[model samples]
Target: MPAATPPAPRRSAPDSRIRRMIRIALRILLFGLLGAIVALLIAVFVTASTLPSFQDLMQKPNGQTVRVHAADGTLIVALGPSYGDWLTYDKIPSTMRDAIVAVEDRRFYSHWGIDPVGVARSVYVARRLKAEGRRLQGASTITQQLARNIFLSSAYNYGRKVREAIIALALERKFTKQQILELYLNRVYFGGGSYGVDAASRKFFGHSGDHMSLAEAAIVAGLVKAPSHYSPSADPQASVDRANVVLDVMQDAGAITPAQAKAAHPEQVQFAPEPKQNSVRYFTDWALAQLDTLVDEQTAPLDVWTTLDLKMQKAADDAIRANTPKDLQGALISMENDGAVRAMVGGTDYVTSIYNRTTQSQRQPGSSFKLFVYLAALEAGVKPSDPVTDEPITIDGWSPRNSSRRFLGDIDVRNAFALSINTVAAKLGQRVGFEQVANMAHRFGITTPINTHPSMVLGTSDVRLIDMTRAFASVSNNGNAVTPYGILKVTTTDGTVIYQHDAGEPRVLVAPYVAAEMTDLLQTAVNTGTARAAQIGRPVAGKTGTTTSNKDGWFLGFSSGLTTGVWMGRDDAKAVPGMQGGRNPAQAFAAYMRVALQPRPVEKFQTDVTLPEWQLEPDDEAYYGNPDQAFGNEGAPQEGDQPAPKEDVAPQNPDEIDDRGPPAERPQRQRQSDGDKPPQLDQKWLDGVLGNRRQPQPQEQPH
Candidate 1:
């Protein structure tokens, strides 16, 4: 009786607190399950809404192929829309399929497009590497990569990643696994300008994808990660190493035996010979770079008409190949007076080096920069016949010497320029403030930064060859500004004009008289100065530029209707023995010009001497009126009164005066601490009227 009563009281259908706790736990579990179910439904709906239809997938637009042509419609090269024969799933060998899966996506068959395990691992690695300050690595699966490659840009971010995941999941749900794999294999890039597995097999092994061996398949699979870095043609050993990795992965995945992988590891890969018709590859590359800028959006195949003259391009390429030194590189660019780039040779060989030196490289212009200084002086009322003493003088601590280390007592400004005299140029730069000279250069289309340093007059500042050529073109076109242009028009395959260049009226850069005078002076330089070798059978105006240690040599000149510039230098900036602007660069220019000007009629430069030559009157009072002024002492002697030679004058050769460097074994003066400051002219010499009235004393003679 006692036991029954206790049991009945104790049960009491459990305590109130325990019962309430159980009810609360059940409610929470039920709500959580409902929430999770709703979330999954929403995810499925969103992914399905974003999925491309079967028809949309089938009608996916192929990448547009851009075909670049010369002005005359000669095809230069073609890029993109490069697809091999369509590969079906059955045609793909198991080795090829498994190799891609093993290396690119380990859980391809098990995961639903996105692998959570792989994502977690990638997050951990990315965080660890970010803390160590390394470049972020990717954890993209094959499906994710395909989605980005086909539908999105290569930009990597959380937003893009999320979108990529959604698209990948949608893609997996819409297509069969085999179908997705077929699409990926057909769309993957395999380097050497190849776009698919079949194309890659043909390019690397000179065969079809169906006939590829296990090693070949592995090699092709490895290139999907980085085509250029693992191209068998460019770097065979790197391709082999990457292929070995793929083979190991395949063996681990049970697709291939360990013994089979070991046997294929040491096998040599035979690559096809690269095509020799890629002569215009560099030009095509440059044209492609400009395509986006020339057109807003390239939605279809484009027919781009370039400014290239095929005949001139061939001549320039041949000249550069035949004349350039074996160890050095060279570039040549020829353009019309209005800045239409006619022929451009970016380097000695486009296959060996893809850098466009004509448009990309910046090097010291050497004496070629003197053209700007002389032009500035002319604009400032300094005449070609004006007398300038070429004696050794020190500015602060820097004393620049001529190549011969011998100074001419007095010479006309024209002769000084023809001989590329460093001192006369420096003095002229000082007389007309360096700022004015820099402004004048900027007006003529030199975009490089110019420092207000005395040495800048001697061509110490670096400049691109194209800009320098444009500056000279301004002088050739009678003071008109020239803008260098390449593309003439771009048309889509549907005959719609995407871009058409309108050649506008040339802008005047300088006064017509100033241009004529500069042209005359440049003519003298090519006729009798360092650029003598650049002379063709016609009248030409050009300047020779040789940098210190013979590191860079340039010949920038213009004929009546065409302007061509040649640059020769080593890529490493190492000195080329005995190299000068008048040597190889001049010869190459002459060779190219001879052929380029063959079909065109020779035109003469218009000699319009409207500006009168500035005259200096010989008077003790008016000439020396501004004795305290640093410059603007206009009344120096005209040309008649010859200055007597100083006692310790050294004989100099006119031929050697054009050298930019000092004589062999002669030490150059230490550059002044105030080298950037303008060199001060001696007022006493200006007062003495260039040593005509009395003996002139230099402010500071060179040691």
Candidate 2:
């Protein structure tokens, strides 16, 4: 059937003008679309150029960071630049220069501004990657990248491509091939807050670009592909593998000999973590706070000079926060006698809250305030062997009981203060005059809303951790109370000194001998008393304090030159389960002191710094008389008796209650001393304080 169709030759048909017209229309349509795209690119460039200059993307020269040098300007923290000091081409190590050239663009030096062969290879790769739905990722020339990062608008479109090409050409024209390459090397961003080879060099290798090793240079060079993904500082082993790839590329390009490349690749090159850089973040924060305060928040910014030993700060914070328990949060403050806060930790993790709890939270002094009691007592000429009565004495129907409710018949004052005997302190407060004790605390820098009542003997008034710290620091400074000044010397970004710290002559609240005796008592507290665990091998002195219900736990201590305060508790005022000042705060205090004293010359407090003429002898009569037995001896069901908690409420460690409470809200109980007593026992007071068992016998236990 098919053979019959060959008979007639098909007539040559005339061209169909309609079809030609359609072809013509199609061509016009393609051209129109091309023209539209080109027009859009031109418009984008014109608009972008008029907008903010791309130069703003590069760093500005505001000098935000002022290099706080060591006494020798040893580059503690670079004050201004986002990265580090710039390095010129000649200063950059040849290994890095070659590695980057080899890895990024082998023909960078030989290409006539563009590498066609590389581009073709890249096009192949991009097409392959695109087939898998890739966005056509890079093989970008350093020049192209620099043009993007420093000059291009970064909109990621054809317009940006056109702009990048123009800038690359412009750069090529403005500088020699080597100069352009150098600029590219210096302008590329590296992860870890670094820009340029110089910054990347120091940031990754802990050295300048001039001294970078080949392995180190390769690591930095390889980072160009994906700084965040490939940074050596983030993952060293992975970076090393990438660096080895760069080394092989360099060898292939003949940029370095195989032997030289092999020699450059170390067994391993680790990019050191800048732990100390952020280690003193607390100090940095404190200084920055001062900066904000001293000058306008926006302008006239002050540069701060501090006695901050960043390395020591790191060590101190690291040690102190190491053993932090799950139930507790701790804060630390380290200061010199001159009121310079050298180190601080706001909380367990400052990344969580920048509150700087060390200087902010105002907590009760507990027994730590008892130091002032001893301080005032010694100034009043009380001897270490002085004795006070332990018997239950009613000061207008209010009886302040001992911690254990068992009083020794007779004890010396020194032992009394060291052992934290509450009744002995109450009796001593009566003799020393509670007003005088309050006045002594004032001279020692505890200027808070101190009630100036008998309770002041047990530190019931409110005082800040910073203020309380300053009080101890004052004793460390030989009884010279100085308000802590974290800002040492403030300067403009240009290094002009604007404000400096200088607290006047020492305000001696207690005589030299009196202060020394108190210091000796504090030392005993560490050696054998509540703060025993905080002993720092050296002759360090410390006192421990806890607010009621474990809301605040404290340990304040000092070495020969430095004083530190540590507090642990819940931020929300919820009790810390079962914490005690001597339990964890003391442990943290000792650890921090150990690290802080590493570089210092080991020394004890000056024997003559503040020697108290008055000795501290424990009062034996005050503590050791059993309370249960005493009450039982007086007959069990007296009409005016007290009911103790059935569950005992953990015995209310008078030490914990000594500090103004988190739970014992309302005005704290007054002391049996100073003619002031726990408020006159009205029926209402008894009902609330000791639940309504008017029969006055122990109530049913909670258990």
Candidate 3:
């Protein structure tokens, strides 16, 4: 009864009740807003604590400058302070400034530090894209980009973005809008190791940014997104395509008229000639890696002289690009007989990949490895004319067949090597001892592990292109071991010689007579054997090698005192259809050699080796019957003896005997009555081959 009476007396209007509730809600919202602002301020201060001072940030990055020069003292590249000069806002071309704004940030001029509109739009777009399983997009202003380039890394994460934003706001508070733009123009990266608009303009157009044309400005602007992908020196057409997009965006932003944008023929803009090959970047990287080992401290500037021939580098680059298929990659290493690496093309293009295949990659050398095998055999006094049976043979439990899947009954060592006869090589490895072959490789400067399996005679082990090039360079050098060197000298800005290459007396690894015999055999290989495609109208000696399934192709040889090795394969070690050493790799070798040897006079090999005089019976049709035959010009298939299939015509290109041969389908050959015997394995003979010479140690190569 008491509660009923109090309720009746205290009845209030519904409108008043609603007004009271609204006031309570307003207080809660105001408090929540204050808490959020305080939390944001704390985050900003914490991020700002890790930033460098504004004045310090304005200075160049903390590192000593390194100037890399070619063999002729031509400046190849500079490491630090790569900018041409600090360009003021007025000195930058208006077109370039406008193009950067149009492509990088549409609201650059209107925003203080962060654009709320851009942030919101980017968030919405990012959410929508995430729903479709796409990468998140960024909404960075020019100030933010400057903050990242100067202070932070290019990492993408909430923490990094928060730090980036804090630094961006501090930059806005410290400088005027024009000052910010000036700093950006002087510090942004423009690819090809260029920093700043002036440096990029000078590098690409051979001029300053102050005089850039509209199209050239657009090209430079387009590189901001991805420097390497749109590098003018690497891919001119791609730069033009990206520049056209920038032009369209600039026109849409009202920075230029439609007619002006349409008239901008970026496609016709001719870039300046690069003083160095993109491959030279690979060489510089290699040289730099050894710099730390050579110098105790890098606190001061440096001047590095490297043994890179621009002409030869250009030729090597062009040869690989012109010969290699689009989907594949190739590597080439060319060194003088003295072991100075003249030209090294690590891959087809350095911009797309930084891997130095010449020094880093280890792939099967295929039959190009036979140089060691034959050298070992020659050291054992097995003359090039010594007869070896090419009939099918097995070592241990493994049977090695020829790539042609057919064999000539008997052939001399010279033809067997020229044809890359696997059976004969297997027999020779067993007769000479596999350990001797491995010792021969190590003596020739091969540092990689060499497995002595019987199949090792067929190059079953992997080797680097540079090492293989050195092996052949030793042969070309008349049995002298080679240590491939790239850097000629290193000095400080004041000309203090910090490091200098020692061109010491050549170390003898193989006997001169054996090397001479091997060279003769290799010459026959390129002149009339599998490497016929490698002939450059001069005395050239090299071998062709293709691996099983065509996974790798190689051609290693020497011409005119210059030794080079060419290798073509996929990174994944997959098969490249229709690829053969004699076809692409040998062609590449020939093309490069033709240009490399142009400036030098043609030279002949040493022919003073003392050996027994021997001659082939004749080029009798009955003996050298089939041009496709591996050997046996004197013997043809007899009655009921089937002719070898045409598919069995070995290109003498690669390694391994075909594993697809049928045991019962083997072709029968006319046997010869020659009573020559194969070299038998004997301890006395082994000791005589090794002699009293010391085994050569693996030299530490500088790449």
Candidate 4:
């Protein structure tokens, strides 16, 4: 009975079998885990093999800085890459290196390029933060940071992180610890357009990195996490607080004693005076903007030899600063007769406002636009001495009035233009057809669209100051079309020319006589008209323009050698009370030109066109009026005096006169004589000027 009871309590075979299976399963799982770790190591090794060679790593491409030089080889500015003199590991102070390590990576020397413990901790924190919906913080070592900045784009993703880690490992294998630390210090960004520890040290302390004190080194090290946020220039107090944290960390890491950390932490940091952020910044910006179209590619650093004359640039800056009101803004552009931009002050202060009013702004030209209208009339058989009534006039339901609101009854074309009579310009624009006026402007290099309204003659159309200055240069250059250009030549640092300006054969767009007459007319303006204030004691020709409500005032003028344009207005286009083209703009023009043209020899305009007698019919009272009464005795010639005679006019047959349609439809007249036939019009020039007009056929006049 006892034996049978004991047999019943015997162990189950199934339980023993289950225990054996559990042991086998545990052994298999352990092997599988080991295989996975080995596979991961192989993947990491393969990825690291793709890294750059040691030489390639050492010669990594940092963005090149662009150096802008004036035509005479004076440095205008240096921009683009914010690099400074490269420093070797030996040149860097031990204190500076220790400060960086204490703040950036405490175990920098102990860890293999990628810190496994740091990565694991970062993953754990990241998981917790993800559950709580927080921004993921970075746990990159200095080596990892250098790898990203040197070889990778600033993309934050799993794939990018993997590549960054593998490259960091490769960097550790190829370069010594000191070399890695040196590279990191040389390539780190340090706010305010500074790159590298040397630049940062000099920018904040006005001294080289090797000469920095413990406090100064800590300040530089603190900026590594967030350069802009901790910039001393932007927020000095915040930057000081960040440096204190670095000092405490240095003390804990035994890089500095507690007393030393305390002494350095509270020490006042004297930062260097901020460098003139962008001297001639507006000009540099505009020049670089043009470089995009001028050069085929900007693959390397370029030495841009600009048309800028630094002396003239300084003059323009002084003139704008002295003449422009504090609240209001202004722009000045000075150029050569061949369209070489010599000086450009885009705004009163490039630091306060970078809006380039000279090249970017398109304000109303006001009366300054009448030059084109008068030129169109001159091309259409109207002489500068032709009769022009400055009485009230209207076209297309739009009435134009003079700035003075008083009409100068009937005046000659020269006086009418000199006085900037809005009515006469409007009437002439209507007579010659607005299309012709627009064409004339286009030929003079006014690329802005011109409305065909009669008011366009009064400069109601908006135009850039650079374009307007270029247009006036045509008058100064004897009818040659002027194309405004800034960059003379662009070359690499090694002197390989990338772009060179070759102003091709000059395009004579305006008739020679027309240019001479236009110059004469504009000279009269500067000498005795609304632009008298713009005179610079030289043979100068210019026009004054005031828009409606005094919103914009302009003085655009040129001498034999230089052409300068000044614009004064509020950036908001609001009216500046009591402002006029003859006021501040004219004064600034005069001031700048006096200094700009001081060295250049004074040259007079060539008045070469032949003169013709004034032909007056019995009923031609409008052609010869009371000059004193017309011009208020200010600029009017003593009564009965006339401007220089025009070229001879060929007698027109009565039948041929009938063939000429109404004033608006008539083709531009040709110079004709008894023995000579009328010359055919230059259709190409005409078409270019008068956009898309039917070409006129050459016709013989009956003798």
Instruction: Identify the leading candidate in terms of lDDT.
Output: 3
User: On residues 431-540, what C-alpha lDDT tens digit does candidate 3 reach at each position?
Assistant: 77777787678767777888776667767678899999999998898777788888999999989999999888656665565677889899988876778799999999
Residue 583, candidate 1: C-alpha displacement in angstroms:
0.6
- Tell me the tens digit of each residue's lDDT in model 1 across 1-703: 5665444445455587799999999999999999977875577568768777654654435777888889899887877755677678899877889899999998999898899999899888988898999856558889998889877888877789877887887788878898889888878888877777888888888888876788999999998888889898888889999999999888888888988998885358777887775446666676678778778866677898998888888998998988898889999888898788888888987777778898899888888888889887776666666788988765444456666445667878876776677778878877776665665666677777876655667676678988899999889987777888889888888788878888785565555556777887888777655677888988888888887667788898998689999999998888776778878999999999999998878777654212223322323232222111101111111134232111121222112221122123222231223333222323343223222243333765555
RMSD of each: 13.8, 15.2, 11.7, 10.8
Q: What's the lDDT for all of these models?
A: 0.74, 0.65, 0.78, 0.76
Structural similarity to truth (TM-score) of each candidate: 0.80, 0.51, 0.62, 0.69
Q: Of the candidates numbered 1 and 4, which has the greater lDDT value?
A: 4
Compare candidates 1 and 4 on TM-score and give the better one: 1
Which sequence of candidate numbers ranks them by lDDT, best first? 3, 4, 1, 2
Model 4: how far is 688 from its true place, Å?
8.5
Model 2 scores what on Cα lDDT? 0.65
- The residue-by-residue lDDT of candidate 2 on 1-703, one tens digit each, is 5665557765454556677888999999999999987885565555445534333433433424454543223445554445566566787788878888888877777765556887798889988888898776666676777678766666768877876766665555545776667667767778766778888877777777778888888888889888888876566667878888888888888888878887876447756565543435656666666665665534344455667766657766775568577756778888888887777777776654556677777776666778777776666556565676556653333355555556555767766666676666766766666665665566566657665444455566767777778888877776655567655666766777777766765444434445566777777667655677788778888888766555677889898678898887777878665566777888888888888787788776544223323334434244322211111221121235443111111211111212111222211221133343222213333233323344433564453
Clashing residue pairs in all predictions, respectively, total 0, 46, 5, 2
Provide the lowest-lDDT 10-residue window in model 4.
626-635
